[model samples]
Target chain A: MPGQTTASLPRVAITTGEPAGIGPELTLMLAMQAATLPAQVVAIGDPDLLSSRARSLALDIDIVPCRPGDDLPAPQAGRLSVWPVSLRAPSLAGTLDPANGAYVLDTLDLAIAACRHGQASAMVTAPLHKGAIIDGGHPGFTGHTEYLRDACGVDEVVMMLATDQALHGVAHGDTSCPLRVALATTHLPLRDVADALTAERLERILRVLDGDLKRHFGIVSPRILVCGLNPHAGEGGHLGREEIEVIEPTLNRLRTEGLDLTGPLPADTLFTPRHLATADAVLAMYHDQGLPVLKYAGFGRGANITLGLPLVRTSVDHGTALDLAGKGTADPGSLRVAVSLAADMARHGQ
Target chain B: MSQAQPCIALTLGDPAGIGPELVAKLLEQRDVVGKANIVVVGDRWVWEEGQRVAGIHHEIPEISSLAEARDQTGPVLLPTSTIKPEDVEYARINGLCGTSVLEVLKLCMDGASAGQVDAICFAPLNKLSMKQGGLKHEDELHFFVDHLKVETPVCEFNTLGNLWTSRISSHIPLAEAASHVTSERILSATQLIHDALIAAGIEQPRIGVAALNPHAGEGGTCGREEIDIIAPAIDACRDAGYAAQGPFPADTIFRRARDGEFDGVVTMYHDQGQIALKLMGFERGVTVQGGLPIPITTPAHGTAFDIAGKGRANVEAMRHAFDIACRMGRHHASR
Candidate 1:
């Protein structure tokens, strides 16, 4: 439970994901840099585990243990603020133990509760090994984003990977440069991407993407580019006609609603440097179709953000590297970016 | 060879496939080196083994640069390999062989970018073989696009008898393929095909757009895609000065186009055009990446991993790929 008071600072709950992965290391790394962050950050995991991780990584951070109803501690210069949620069993550095799955879930549940009760302004989640989490009896949790969605009771969410590129601006300011992409359908088998692209679904996704871009990134009217489902966008029915029959009408409908949108362009050609330079974001047809390009563009440095959620949430665009766990060598660049994005979005005040 | 022209970097596709054999058979053509410089971008041992199996006696040109083969006659080989040729077993997917193939493509593309090579032609590479090679891309073309960061729309065009260019869906699931058909996409594909044909020097190319459902939806009784969506798009393209016609029954459209009824056919999905074109002239089929700054052409077949190490691969498609690449390259160069 979080402290209740008017003066209680808004907390940003961080879930140190799967116990045996790089989650603990990344959490410790971010904790080292917590002094520079603006929001109140809290890690819902064991304090001793974080301390051990910090020691292994050669990081010096004090661990402030808190119980339920305890006042959130002011983040110290070289210390980690922890809301202790003990693990059931001892965790090995590289091996995933099924016994700690409930502990991971409990951490997330506590963080979500903090956000729901207005104790936390937003949440930054570390990577979790989905397979281990599933094998640990929490059969429904697929990935961190899905788990967050269900925990927050959001009906639908779009995953966007954002990165910044320098551009000639009107003034000497850190321009709010973001390359945002939202998928019409995600995590589906490749065979199902086309049938799943309905006009209604596409319209909804575009609308949500537009709204989120405005709210989170402060783009007044973000230009949305769409990739066609078929090859050559159906080659006028030569390759496939999903573009002609399905995608066009949906775009037409969106156009009538006055959205700045373009395409049904061939997916193969949509990711070129010239075209990508002209649009604010791209709405990809499916997972593999769009993500390969995005991942290629910003592999380990991109941040995964969930739109259409009630609270601000951003995460590292990577999975729990069980192999690299406990090595104290996990890259904290993405975690730092996720925290920065969460703070930025919170400042924007959706 | 005539003035030692720049070699067209060619990739010997899958080791288990027909790529090695195809390269062997292609090199046997005396006139191939006469057209443009040819460089085989693959393992030297693989080429030698292919030469032995194909029973073609030709000296493998061992040179680092295309300029080295400038005055010499016969095909030049720029050997690239990740593993020993002896290590690759036929018909089996080997990650090393796949990675080698990708490395070859990357090297060739790099050379082309630096003006070291004039153009490139690819032999078929198996998708599964590439997966074994640890490639994360959907296809070779996608890999190129990612590497180059090309902005122009790279579309796959299959030229059947130099008469029609067809495609709709290239690589996607069938269920998803149908829903992707849209009026705007049809219009864009029609526009690109029309522009490609005109650029190929055809004036006002006649294009036939195929219907998604059977019989152009039999006037909406069979399906509404033709009546409700496709027909309107065809009309829009016509208004834009393209001689586009269709929502024709997919079954008969290809035949009509074959009979000189239309200059090209707009297909609804991958197999729709591929089936007709492959049947018409599978051996002579050529693939063109339209809307690219440079016209990129390749043989339609992939590396035949099964017969790759053996020298039984056909060279007709490779020959056609070269012919088309040369023609397109010349056309673009002149422009």
Candidate 2:
């Protein structure tokens, strides 16, 4: 429907994360709706686990076991091409086992390798259980972004969440543009958010946000709206000094280098349609400031994209939903969007 | 005028700001005039300037005192102080204008104390102007607390449509927000909003408290504020018989509230609730001064100095402020 013939469709590799969680069923659900998707999706997990989950969910897809770079059949419903990896321990739905933790990491490593070797155009990931991975003996397991950064040997990557659902009439300068929010700092205490924002860090984050919008999103010169660390953007130092000391200085230096950046504006007013309508992306100073609004605007329908990466990777904006795993009611909306976004980014590269 | 109508004292917030023009736009609406016995309290010349900026005029009768305005319905002007139209500097903060704004609000507060007014809905005020106008307190709420001699807890409740939010710490440094997340403050904010929502006609409001840390501290790996501070305060709220839930992660809690999961949310700091509420509806948000003896409300927006005297301020927030004041005033009147 989007002018892609079946042979020319880009290949998207999806990892079934945290086998005990809803990742397997969500993957199977995505495969069943392959005709509506923009790319050829290959589920990179244990073929047996997907088959079991598919049976439980009553899906009628044929789980064809294939390898990376295999000549897969044309896109069709009820036909899933799986680059099979064996599970170290059999996984049960709705039950987390640390024994299968390495299995989860194995799936990710395989997807990364495949994408690196040109076997897949891009990779989309479902949610993984951090606790299981940590307990299964990788003590420094922080998150998927950190894992990918380390696996790829990159110094840093920006976590940006976006949704095709238009926030307002003029959101992102168009009625149909997606709202993208990238954080300068992630997963620190509220008290530590200020200390984490140095001039160097802000410069690097802004550069990455700007560069990736051009390289990945196809925006030639991205206009990013930045948020200040303090309330009312420090209200000209009556509220706080971060805007004066750190944010403004960094933005001024970058602006002279020809970056189209605005604000040190108030976070409360920055997310409004008046300002958001003019941004390609927003760089919030911390996690809570930008995310709460983005999630509220596009929860359950958003995709989490990792910028500054050597390869294009997108993930669902939600979690594994361990409670609703076996119940077959977990929504595949985010995974579908993630795969669709990854497909778009792959096409952009081409 | 009908005795059934409650008297509302409306002040032109900061003469330099767009408050006067917004109040002037609000007065042109016939339905707002018919709902309450509206008394416009400010300098007569400034009120006329608002009318001129708004490009509208009304023959509001002049009242010499609050006692005269108490019995009259429709829009009545009580010129407590004088500022000439030529002396008014639009969009520039002046001590004289600030002092005049404080005096006008003080008169209304005194009238409210004397039972001469049921509610007070003022236009947006400039904090720096008020401070330059000789305000000793950090903000107007503190000034009101001192003036009204309120010994109990007080917080500002921001409402968008049906969802209400109150914060424990506001107008402080982000670094210091964690230090203010004590159990005592959270309970105080919860109690205040719970009572205020009831007074505003919500029966048994369910309040959702936000976690102070990210992912609710991820079970104390990231920060201890959620475990050590926020949860205990939420427990205290439950024991106190208020329908309260969560120390939910700040990011997703607002979505739940927006989707009708809760009637209100009590946040640990300002931007946690503000970033969500303003994004949800910036033009329709109203700020209600909670735990006050008399009902007080204002537009949650500030004095838009960039567009002051442009005669194009959106009057929806101002109108909602008036409607809330009238609603709360009616409840206060019946009680």
Candidate 3:
């Protein structure tokens, strides 16, 4: 029934990541299997790279090109509608060139602009190579989430990695399952993490994550579990005072707001099957604290979603596999999942 | 006489705190006595009070010397005071009780230095109470280090299957911590951990040194501490036949350590290793003072003053500390 419903399908924009990496190959693979997706998709990147990748993979698809100021056309079944952003040279597969860095930025800029201007409802991005971008003379962003934050002119954003409820699902009750996981402090240095952590920061991230879980995933009052920064949550300040002075007080304040939240539990044993079974989402302290387990749990199929942004944005959790680019053997599992998630979020958006 | 079994002179830290109760709970385990003889150094009255609280009627063997400890069947008690048990209150600092803790430590260290005890495993000592008791040192470890005056780069290490060693000086200001991180200090810390791990039977151990800067200086964009100091020290260690690597991003090095990519890590400051090691396995982790004349181990934790004497203190860390001390003692003896 969900798949048969075509009238509610949304228009999604996808940014093909670094031209020389697996982004082009994977984008082509997803286009070849586009009929299975729940929305019409438009790709923003060089058209030549997409065609060559599709041909190399032995997959055929129609390519519709658009120019600036041209009226957007409806996507055709078994075809990909691409708005070509001209590049200085042809994007070669598996070869990173600083000359094409501007092209990558242009593709993302156009895709995000479309989403902001109401031309597209949601956006899915492929991974970008940081080294190449830096070499291109653009102040290289920390990552896509931060770049999106600055590009869209938003203040805060949280990074979440989600997998299918079927494979990584925890039984909530007699008849319920949902996707989960949110990070509090994302991509920070070890020393700066403690100072960056605060009651307000954690409460804001959790509140945003809780709202998204309900709006996008159709789960109400999601049960959120928070992990502590120190060992055993500071063992009542015997190990460290941050837990008593910061984390516990924040949890209490958030709990008073009538949200179903719990813990500041020991980080080591918090990921057991029984604990995750009842939790709709787990809030980790930093990148390594949470991503390792989430990536391990989902492997290459995890989709990373950015919360607190005005528009829906999601991406494949895996980085751009430059070594596997152009071989036509790169996996499209995570990219496909990212596109599906973006579509789902778009359908449930305000 | 039967060979003197490797004995751990366990100091009952802060008599007014939970140290006494935790020691009592630890001694109740049969496996503890099976491992090594535990000689509790503290006030005799505190031990009696601990027994009453734990509801176990066990005789206290008052031994005058380590030679007399060889014949004792249960935990030998080396009493340090004549104060009555009723005079001390739970979770409250008293000058007499605090002084007794320091005295016991000194006696235990003297015994350990004389080779009367193979290792020393201690409970958590309250620094505030020690200061209140007129002790003229920052901490018990500093006092011990200064008293021995036989230093070859003694550093504190916390182990939970994965090991974390500190390179920079601890308990100072953050600005001072950064200043103290020199190539010589980093090289010495790495060598200490590498040699300690190899002595613990880890062959060709891989050691990871976390950077002092974010993104490992990000090519001098952040701070040049990693490039200027940390990397050169790592190179020095490698040239000396040590398999040392990193100045890796501090954000992810601990995860690499957890994944078995490195045998041990030399963190730049206190909380870097403390946070990661504690998060990995707090209950099972043990703190070892590496490069000491005598191998010293304790729980990777402190005095839980809030729940002191509440009969809920977990003894897992303490038990692990004793186990490591005995194992390291045996390794040292064999060598």
- Per-candidate DockQ vs. reference: 0.07, 0.80, 0.10
Task: Give the alpha carbon lDDT tens digit for every residue of B206-272 in model 3.
Answer: 9998887655767876667877788888899899988889888665787678788988888886555
Best by TM-score: 2
Residues A211-281 of candidate 2: C-alpha lDDT, one tens digit per residue: 88888778888889999887788876767899999999999999999999999999999998778778888
- Model 3 chain A: weakest 10-residue lDDT segment is A170-179
Top-DockQ structure, candidate number? 2
Q: How many residue pairs clash in each candidate at the backbone level? A: 45, 0, 0
| lDDT for position A244 in model 1 | 80
Interface RMSD of each: 13.9, 0.9, 6.0
Deviation in Å, model 3, residue B271 alpha carbon = 3.3
List candidate 2 segments past 4 Å from native: A168-177, A298-300, B1-3, B80-89, B93-96, B333-335
RMSD after CA superposition, every candidate: 21.4, 2.1, 5.7
**Tens digit of lDDT per residue, candidate 1, span B1-335?**
23134446666666666776777788778777677766777788777766676777677667776545334455678766566867688877678778877887777777666555566777777665666787787566677777667876556788856665656656764566656688877887888788888777788799999877644555554457777778889899889988888877655676677778888888877655664565455667878767665556677765654455555667888888877766665555455
Candidate 1 lDDT score at position B323? 75
User: Residues B1-335, candidate 2, lDDT per residue (tens digit)?
Assistant: 33367889999988888998999999998888889989999998888888899999999999988877667756899986645567678888777777888899899999989888899999999877777778888678888899999998899999999988999998887988989999999999999889888877789999999998878899998999888888888899999999999899988899899899988899998899998889888999999999889999999998888889989898999999999999888888877
